[model samples]
Target chain A: EPEVTQTPSHQVTQMGQEVILRCVPISNHLYFYWYRQILGQKVEFLVSFYNNEISEKSEIFDDQFSVERPDGSNFTLKIRSTKLEDSAMYFCASRPPGLATFTGELFFGEGSRLTVL
Target chain B: EDQVTQSPEALRLQEGESSSLNCSYTVSGLRGLFWYRQDPGKGPEFLFTLYSAGEEKEKERLKATLTKKESFLHITAPKPEDSATYLCAVLVAGGGADGLTFGKGTHLIIQP
Candidate 1:
């Protein structure tokens, strides 16, 4: 089965540095999303992208965060000036549009673990 | 804010034992409730999505049921491979995009 893929399985960065996590969603899916899980916490939604623009974002998605699908196939999340609190496991996900399927199942990638020192 | 609460933070059961996991939520409008399984160092794998109060779905030894304010994931005759953190999430109606609000998750361990 086709699955979403992510790069830099683990990334260690210093405070005030920049880091970009990349993901390649399923080939045919249109809607894409970014979520993060802090150590021992629930998964939190960061943002959703479609049609080359952001549809919605959570409060946690601050000015320091941004997402792009620059190449149509690659979706990237850039965190500017990482902080200690920014250390977490970031996951990329995707789902198809429309109501054709009975369940709107979303597929997720293995996730990129970001550790800020 | 849409919120979800799952009961029994951790559970350890012998293989072939049966039990149920609970997910309670408070949301503005419910689009759907979803159940996922996550292992260490991996992302969540989809399990079931219950769209309405009376809707239920089953796969293998897992069964999920939904209601207005809560949902339950039942595991019957479980095995050691069934050990994982079970996560429950919700899609709110007229909420931000298709983002899902998730619960803290219940960590389950099945031992032989």
Candidate 2:
């Protein structure tokens, strides 16, 4: 089965440095999303993209965060400057649009673990 | 505000043992509920979707049931491979993009 894939399975960065997490969602999927899981915490939604634009974002997705689909298959999330709290596993997901009823079956990538020190 | 709460943060069962994990939530407008499994160091894999109250779905050894306020994931005669964190999430149609709100997961350990 085709699956979403992410690059840099693990990333380590300085507290004030920048980091960009990349993902390649399933080719045919139309909607893309980003979510994060802090160690020992629930996975939290960051943002969603469709039609090459941001559809929605959470409070955690503040000015420091940005997402881009620079190419047909790549979806990336960039954090201007990392913080200790930024340490977490970031996952990318995608899904087809317009199902008769919403089921919430978002396909996810393996995830990129980010460690900030 | 929407909130999701899962009970029994962790569970350990011997192989072939059966048990259920609970996921409860409060959403402004409940559109659907989802169940996922995540192994250590991997992303969540979709397992089942419950769209409304009284709906149920199953696959292999796993069965999911939903009610207005909560959902349950029952694992029957589970094997060691069935051990993983079971996550539950709810989608709110009238809310933000993707419309998802998740609860902390229930970590299940099946020992062979």
Candidate 3:
């Protein structure tokens, strides 16, 4: 079974530094998303990307956060300046084309753990 | 705002025991309800998608049922390997590009 793959399984960055988490979603999928889970918190949506554009974003995805699909296979989330509160596990997910509207079953990567200090 | 509440923050059962996990949701228009299983240090693994009220899906020893206001994940004859955090989420109609809104999740432990 094909799965979403994320790079840099764990990252530790200084406060005010920049970090970019990368993901390679399933090849044939059309929609991609980013979500994060703070320690002991529920998963929160960040943004969704489709057709090289952002479809929707949350308040948590503020000015400092951005996402890009620079290539056919890579989806990335960049934070301009990391904060202590930014520490969390970031997940990348993708959904197949035809099933996008029929179900909410998203295939997720193992996740990238970010630690800001 | 769409909200999902999962009951019984944690549960422990002996092997071969059976139980159910509850997910109560409040959303404007229900698009879909999903159930996922997550282990430590891993992302969520999709298990079932219930699109409408009265819909149900099953896999192995797991069965998921949906109603107008809530959903239930029933585990029958569970084993130690079934231990994991079960997450429930909701997709509301016209939710745009936003992804699913998740609950806090229920931690399940099955002991032999």
Candidate 4:
């Protein structure tokens, strides 16, 4: 089955450095999202995108965070000036546009582990 | 804010053991409740989605039930491969936020 794919399985960066995490959602999927999981914690929503624009975002998705679909097949999340607390496993997910059989499914990528030093 | 609480924090079961995991939730309005499985260092894998009260769905060795207030994931004759952290999330209706509010998750260990 086709699955979401993310790049840079793991990344380590200085506290003040910038980081960009990339993802390619399933070919037929239309809704894209970014979520993060701090070590041993819950998965928290960051943002959702559709129609090539941001649909919604959470408080955690502050000014430091930004997402873009720079190309037809790529979705990217950039973190400006990472902090120690920014370290976490960031996941990219997508779902096909709502249809008769839709029951709220979000397919996810393997995730990118970010470690801030 | 939407909230989801899963219990107990962890569970350990011997092979072929049957058990149930609980997911309690509070949302402004229910859109759907979702279940996912996560292995260490991996993103969550979607398992099931229950859209309304009294609805149920099943997969091999797994059955999920939903209610107005909570949901349950029952595992029958489970194998070690079934071991993983199970997460439950909620999507609120009319919230304009398609993002999910996830529970901390229940970590299950099935020993063969």
Model 2 C-alpha lDDT per residue in residues A1-80, reported as the tens digit of each score? 99999989999999999999999999999899999999999999999998999999989999999999999889999999
How would you encode candidate 4's per-residue C-alpha lDDT over B16-94 as one tens digit per residue?
9999999999888988899999998788999999998999999999999998899999999999999999999998877
Candidate 3 structure quality by residue, lDDT tens digits, A31-88: 9999999999999999998899999898899999999999889999999999999999
Docking class of 2: medium
**Which model is ahead, 3 or 4, in terms of lDDT?**
3
In model 2, what lDDT does residue A35 have?
Answer: 96
- Candidate achieving the largest lDDT: 3
In candidate 3, what are the lDDT values of residues B1-112, reduced to their tens digit? Answer: 7889999999999999999999999999988899999999999999999988999999999999999999999999999999999999998878464478999999999999
- Backbone clash numbers for all candidates listed: 0, 0, 0, 0
**Pairs that collide, model 2:** none
Please give the TM-score of chain B in predicted model 4.
0.97
Error of 3 at B10 (Å): 0.6
Q: Once model 1 is optimally superposed onto the true structure by TM-score, how far is the C-alpha of residue A54 displaced, in angstroms?
A: 0.3
Give the Å error, residue A33, model 3.
Answer: 0.6
Second chain TM-score, each model: 0.97, 0.95, 0.97, 0.97
Looking at model 4, residue A70 earns an lDDT score of: 96
Candidate 2: deviation at residue B24, Å? 1.0
Residue A92, candidate 4: Cα error in Å is 0.5
lDDT of 1 by residue, A1-117 (tens): 899999999999999999999999999989899999999999999999989999999999999999999896999999999999999999999998776532547799999999999
Lowest summed-lDDT stretch of 10 residues in model 4 chain B? B91-100
Give candidate 1's TM-score: 0.97
Interface RMSD of 4: 1.2
lDDT of 1 by residue, B18-105 (tens): 9999999999988889999999899999999999999999999999999899999999999999999999999888844588889999
